[model samples]
Target: MLWETPFGHYYGDNRENNGNYFANDISNFYEELIKKCNFRIGEGFYVNILKNYLSILKEDSEYLYYFKIKPLISILECEQYLKLSPNKEVRDLYLECLNECSSLYNKYMNVAR
Candidate 1:
């Protein structure tokens, strides 16, 4: 649902303004997706939503920190993140986030280096 949020789109190319809004949307979507996963909404269903969420992050250079940069950095600092649910499918979704986020994260990092 968070393809290109109203808030983020309003901010447009203004990274400074868009950052916080994008960050909020990213954080909220992740948590909401976890809730959906816990509800046992089916792996395939949530996977599409999660993929869309990640796609939003990957494509938006202005708010890369929220999706690609900050999350990977936190994982690096903490070594690992929490499991959203004990269910296998839920865990799979979580891993998918990590995988997709990491791909974008690596891409950004490589360009920076």
Candidate 2:
């Protein structure tokens, strides 16, 4: 599967040796679970990949610059706005994503402005 981000695009194969990995399928499953929580989400489940994607951009760094975090901040802003939607379920789902995003930032990608 291919994962694209603001930084770059990554190409990876699920077929490693003799085993066939179903990572994207598993991701789709999570995506569905999270999507069920939000009625208005456009991109489906986006909860699991941001950190891993960013880590690909900076393997050795424990922190990233504020400028380099525009993508994350944009997602955070969207989550905040989504939390205000009339749909209670979407708001709750956005809240869940927001909380998890915050935790990820605090743990792995401390922004240095």
lDDT per residue (tens digit) for residues 1-113 in model 1: 32467434544566666678788887886786567545644545755665565565555554346453575446433423325554665466556667766766676677778
Clashes of each: 0, 0
For model 1, the stretches where C-alpha displacement exceeds 4 angstroms are 1-84
User: Which candidate leads the pack in TM-score?
Assistant: 1
Model 2, C-alpha of 6: deviation from truth (Å) = 30
- Candidate 1 overall lDDT versus native: 0.57
Q: Which ten residues in a row have the lowest lDDT in candidate 2?
A: 14-23
Name model 2 segments beyond 4 Å from true. Answer: 1-73, 109-113
Top lDDT prediction, candidate number: 1
What is the C-alpha local distance difference test score of each model?
A: 0.57, 0.49
Estimate the TM-score of every prediction.
Answer: 0.35, 0.33
